[model samples]
Target chain A: MANGTLVLIPTPLSGQPLAFSHPPEVLSRIHKITDFAVEKLQQAVHFLVKTGHPVPEYKMGFHPLDKHVTGEQLQDILAVLQQGRDVGVLSEAGCPGIADPGARLVWLCHSRNIPVEALVGPSAITLSVMYSGLNGQQFAFNGYLPVDSHRREQTLKTFEGRSANDEQTQIFIEAPFRNRELLGAMLELLQPETRLCVCWNLMADDQWVVTREVQDWASASLPENFENKPAMFLFLATPRQKAVSGKKSARSKSTGRGSRTTGTKKGLHRKRYNPD
Target chain B: MANGTLVLIPTPLSGQPLAFSHPPEVLSRIHKITDFAVEKLQQAVHFLVKTGHPVPEYKMGFHPLDKHVTGEQLQDILAVLQQGRDVGVLSEAGCPGIADPGARLVWLCHSRNIPVEALVGPSAITLSVMYSGLNGQQFAFNGYLPVDSHRREQTLKTFEGRSANDEQTQIFIEAPFRNRELLGAMLELLQPETRLCVCWNLMADDQWVVTREVQDWASASLPENFENKPAMFLFLATPRQKAVSGKKSARSKSTGRGSRTTGTKKGLHRKRYNPD
Candidate 1:
């Protein structure tokens, strides 16, 4: 018998209606899967119940998928797949395998040649990038900043330099309570012209995403209820003027570069040219 | 009157069923927005028609959103928004403001403090990372590489070196026709231990995502229908052991580092540890 597919399922970002965070088709398609590896069992059960999954919460197999998830536990889930029963991988919030522990399970399935499918859904990282109106063409998600004060300051300066040099957007997240501190430190340490974006309560009724230069942000006041809320922080430094380099400058985009229109008869059209 | 909201809408990846690429809720929510800034007019018309938008495609407003889109065109769109009518931004494929020209419009909105909403949807870049089973926590999307062969070769080596030193998953895209050529160059250029992943025809009937070491890929045969398909290529060089440097190694994670469980009272839990 063929091994069953491993489906990566994304959960809601908040307690908002399912329609706001997921497409109905994804919910319907994954409803039949009786096996799941989830970040937190209670959260997954609540999500399933909210989505009206036909199976009773007690009937489905729920395996812990946190850092402590053991190899033997993964083997057990793999055994279920080998027995021709599909298993779903669900993260606490957002798409599985991106900034979550679910990647370990997906990696395991790939090593064994078991097919893996990642469904379309919301990601805070992706949404924050979009809402920030920053450089999405070239960006990096650095997960979390160093907790230490001195190190975090140095890291911020380094990221700002890299961003200015490469024109790449730098993204990272902070725990809700510590967000204010991070912002405060950013205002104090980052360059005056650096742009900073704070995205809070994504997909919620009162979702907020704002961007401004560090100088502007220094004078602005954050929302009253900004603390204790899920947030994503992003920054971009003003791109520096091209320095005179001896070797062929790799940063030059004088050559045409644009999106490749796939499955179109027009083939390739160089529509955009962004200068350094 | 308050300025209208700017909604970032993602289009389908292929000629596949709408249900396969988008959730019903997103289509429904966006159906009533008659004003749009799209990469191409015909493509947006087809997507709206297929999704069963009630209005006639000809009747709805369509503005070109390519590089050629002028300041006057954007001013017209902004005027409509200032008139309190929501306008949608649609890319050729995937999410708007991401690896596309929609970002320029988005930046315009941000400069004016116009509201922007990013709905949940598909992004080939995000999906490829999830399916690659690579490091999604710390990854960078470098858009496209230099097209010149010599520069392209040097860029590939630079990306590989960065990946090894930073433990980052390096991602880039190529025109469908040139994907095979890119893979050929990667095989000859990347180190033996570096892992490479090719994700082609995402969300299609025969979607293929496979990751193998450079040595392994050197001996494998690609699928026959791999050419002329939308694809994302990713590679990760084996992370070199931490070098003993005079200054403190910046990459050290001796302290805790993990996801910040949002909206929950549990605060922070440092679960996983990935050593250098």
Candidate 2:
């Protein structure tokens, strides 16, 4: 028997009752769904209550990372589909499958020939890109880098090589605890001038999206409350050169010296050569 | 005086009737909008008629691209904002400021510190990425590569470098007429097995999104009737090189010279390795 449709639901941001981008109408439709897979049943219940939706009395299947998703779990979800029930999947917060665990389910669904429909909604990745003013043409998302220095360095090198060739933007994330360490590594490895866009607490009232050179970031003091906050780091290669070194000189010129002084004697001379 | 809010209106695909994403309720809310800067005035008039909204009889200003957008034009738009009137900027299709000419107006609004809000709607880039199944975390959106071979090669080289280091996906569009030429160049420059996702006439009934290896694409005949058609090309670097290569080799060994004779031997060897 053909399994039911699997609807991937994106949860709301922290402290915000509304799911990231989904409107009230879409949320209402999702609430009425009878069969579903949720990352956490308790959180799902809380969300429904806060949003003022009647939580359906369903023994929702759980997809916990520590508990390996067994064949029985898969069978139960499939049975819901076989019984003509539309199964919905919800993430804790933000869009599913982007640096989230929903990817495994999405891939499995695709492999099993099940149809997957992704409704448009709020994604920190998209919103960050929009506000960053970085080149949106080509980009790579490397997810979260390894915490170990050696492994992280190897990963960063791979990202650097790719950015050097194509001038494409590279997006990666780090655990809040290791944010300063990762940022420090990036500043040392990447060109001093490489445009880095950091999106912290996106879409929320306290959101901060800033694009700055690596050297500037290195010099500035780290945020006090960055310990447990979710953050996204986006790096755009210098327009002229794909190599990291090329970006260093460009960065110094563009932000460091360029913005400090007016068009005085030396400024006139600099303007003639570098009219940035 | 504080400039008025810039209402960024996303026009429909091909300026056709019923192509807009915004409904009547949304349009009605912004009815007091006076100043207008559109790609084409006639298309704007057509949109108003198709939507059946009350048209403002005021002599609205039109800022066409052919004519330089001077300070006067900027002032005229700002004057409406000063008088508490909202200024609307519309594009030909899809989202404004995304591979569209309306970016200049958006930049102007940003520079003047005017509030700019982008509503959720159909964006060719976002829609293409959603369907491609490629990495959506990091991406670059280079509008259109130069038609000149030298410049095109330079751009491709840049894309290659980025893909290598960051494993970022690179997206670029080509003039409808030169798509075949661009594809040819991509085949020659990119690795034989590099993946390319071609999205043509996206969201329309005749839309097509195909992911294929560069070498395979080269061997196939060029697509017909692509002239003047809107298209987006996405290139993603394959991660886990050894695994992919191993699979390719195994497939070749089975399908090529040894298939008939070695089939039984391979089956026995596989059975011995996995007793289950």
Candidate 3:
């Protein structure tokens, strides 16, 4: 028998109705799968139940999947697929196998020639980029930075250097409780002209997405309740296009070390738009 | 007056029904907006009509937006927002401002303190990471490489070096016409054990997402019609985790230059699963 497909299902980022983030087809797709490997069983059960899955939670196969998911545990999931039953993988939130676990299962299916289908849904990282107003053409999601203040400071310097040198935007996330710590370090360590974007409580009624230069943020503050909510932080230290005497152009500063000097001098005026 | 929100709308990847990739809310949201800045005017009209917008194509405000969107043209869009009228931004496909034009506009909105809202939708980059089954926790989308063969080769070398050094999954794309050329270059240039993933015609009936070592792909061929479709190429040159005596753990290889050597030897057996 042909191996069953492994479907990667993305979940809602907030408590909003599923329709807010997913189309009718995703609802129908969820109804058909009876086996799952999820980041958290309770959350998966809750999401499936919310999706109106016909199967009771008691009868469905729920496998545990986290960063530590083992090869043996994965084999058990593969055994179900080898039996020709489709298994859906879900993250606690957002798309599975991106910032979440279950990638190993997806990789395993690939090795064994099992088909993997990823359903479209909300991804905070993607949303952050779109809302950031930063360079989306080239970017990196560095995941999380080092927790030690000293190491994280060093890492931030490296990321900023790359942003300028490669013209790539750097994106990284933090545990909810550390949002403030990260923001503080960024303001203190990054160059004054570097753009910093903070997106908190995405897809929520109280969501806030803001971008400003580090110098501007030094005096401003995060939302009072932002510390506990999931957030994504991104920055771009790349210089803006060289300013002309008569007109402004949309081109980016060219890449490499020498452009850094030109970018720093001209990029400051990037935030200022005067309708001459 | 408060500046009107700059809504970034994501479009479908293929010609499938809007229901296939977006929810009812997106349609409603599109219907309420009359002003738009689109990558392609014809495609935007087609999409708006498909969404069943009440306004006639002739009656809507459709401004052109591409890499060359001028500071003057953006001033026009901002002028509309300044009047407390919302303006929607659309890419030819997928999410706008992400490997697509319009991020600068999004950035402009941020600079002006205009509320920028990015609705949930399909992102090929996000989907590629999810389906690639590579290291999705950390990844970089390098957009496109140089068109010159030699320059592209050198950039690929740099990307591979970064991937191995930083444990990052590198994502990139090519013009559909040049897909074959890029694939051939990749096969010849990348190391044997590096994993490469190709996702073509995503969200379409004929979509294909596959990941395998460079060695494996060197022996295979792309789908016959893949050359003409919008495609994404991703690779992970990082070494696999250190092999245990009797078990395969899910831990990733550590970051830094030293780990590269350890990753090389142990990673060769990564694809082999002895279910003993």
Q: Candidate 1: global Cα-lDDT?
A: 0.75
Q: Score the docking of each candidate (DockQ).
A: 0.41, 0.09, 0.29
* Per-model TM values vs. the true structure: 0.91, 0.62, 0.87
List the lowest-lDDT window of 10 residues for candidate 2 chain B. B262-271
lDDT over C-alpha atoms for residue A206 of model 2: 64
Q: lDDT scores for all predictions?
A: 0.75, 0.52, 0.76
- What i-RMS does each candidate reach, in Å? 5.5, 15.7, 11.1
> If both were scored by DockQ, which would come out higher, candidate 2 or candidate 3?
3
- Model 3 lDDT at residue A2: 82
Chain A TM-score, prediction 1: 0.89
Candidate 3: list runs displaced more than 4 Å: A240-276, B240-276
Q: Is candidate 1 or candidate 2 better by TM-score?
A: 1
Of the candidates shown, which would achieve the greatest DockQ relative to the real structure?
1
The CAPRI quality class of candidate 2 comes to incorrect
Which stretches of candidate 1 lie above 4 Å from their native place?
A242-276, B243-259, B263-276
**lDDT by residue for model 2 over B6-101, one digit each (tens)?**
665555554323422443333553455646676557777666556565665455555552123455665666666667667776655555445443
Per-candidate TM-score, chain A: 0.89, 0.77, 0.86
TM-score of 1: 0.91
